[model samples]
Target: MTQYWYNVRTHQVEEDAMSDWTQLIGPYPTREEAEQALEKVKERNKSWDPNDTDGDGWADHD
Candidate 1:
């Protein structure tokens, strides 16, 4: 099976893990998921942002 990644720097989806780690978003199972990387990230951030406001708890804090 092939792996997919989202290139953070270029906003492109790739089939291989060829970019730097800091510039990539995932090893998603499908190309479609990788293509919607920004949306995925935004969704995740939205879920986490509220918790971060308290500056406590799990302390993931961004």
Candidate 2:
């Protein structure tokens, strides 16, 4: 299947890794998801925030 990538340097969604890997975000399943890459990153960063003092990207204690 074809893949999509989010180009960080150009802030564009590409059909594939047209640029360097260091400048790309993903092999997202769809263009829509690739387009929203930054938002997804923001959400993830929030989840992993150091000050979270909670889950912080770690497994939760049951």
User: Which numbered prediction scores highest in TM-score against the true structure?
Assistant: 2
Candidate 2 to native Cα RMSD, angstroms: 6.5
What do the candidate models score in CA lDDT, each in turn? 0.80, 0.83
Reference-based TM-score, model 2: 0.76
Off by over 4 Å in 2: 51-62
Q: Please provide, for model 1 over 1-62, each residue's C-alpha lDDT reduced to its tens digit, 9 standing for 90 to 100.
A: 89999998988888888888899988999999999888777666666666645443233544
The true-versus-predicted C-alpha distance at residue 51 of model 2, in Å, is: 4.6
Residues 1-62 of candidate 2: C-alpha lDDT, one tens digit per residue: 88999999999999868899999999999999999998887678667666544634433444
In terms of lDDT, the best-performing candidate is 2
Which sections of candidate 1 miss by over 4 Å?
Answer: 51-62
